[model samples]
Target: MTAAALLLWRDFVRDPARRLWTEDSGCGEWGCCGSPLEARAFLEGVLRGMSRRRSRELRAVVDALDDAY
Candidate 1:
């Protein structure tokens, strides 16, 4: 629920497989806040069975955080 988290979630929605997983896929561009490794790990979990409500919640939290920042 932070600006960084929001940015990451936004980027994730834009590209589902951008992060892929925790491993280095030789292509790192998923990190919206500028942390490919973390982004990749986040994607690994979110990509599998991700829910709309969860996404919305994350987005809302991110938005609030972003505003704070």
Candidate 2:
């Protein structure tokens, strides 16, 4: 992710009220990576019954891609 993308994702995910998805969900903070399409895809894939390991792998992708890291 670029600086702008990182900022967008951080601001969005940090805002509790503005969160794109419900809290404490199985998907967790699944849709706050600065991309609505990416988030949607995450939600769909997870809700579609993907394994927990797969979910972690997906999240790892987000963490790795985030420029803030």
Best model number under lDDT: 1
Per-residue alpha-carbon lDDT of model 2 for 1-69, expressed as tens digits? 333443444555565655444344334343343453355445445535757766676556556544332
Tens-place lDDT digits, model 1, residues 1-69: 234544664554456575464455445554323454464445445534457766676556545533443
How many pairs of residues collide in model 1?
0
User: Which candidate leads the pack in TM-score?
Assistant: 2
Where does candidate 2 stray beyond 4 Å? 20-69
Tell me the TM-score of model 2: 0.29
Clashes of each: 0, 0
Error of 2 at 60 (Å): 7.4
Candidate lDDT (C-alpha), each: 0.50, 0.48
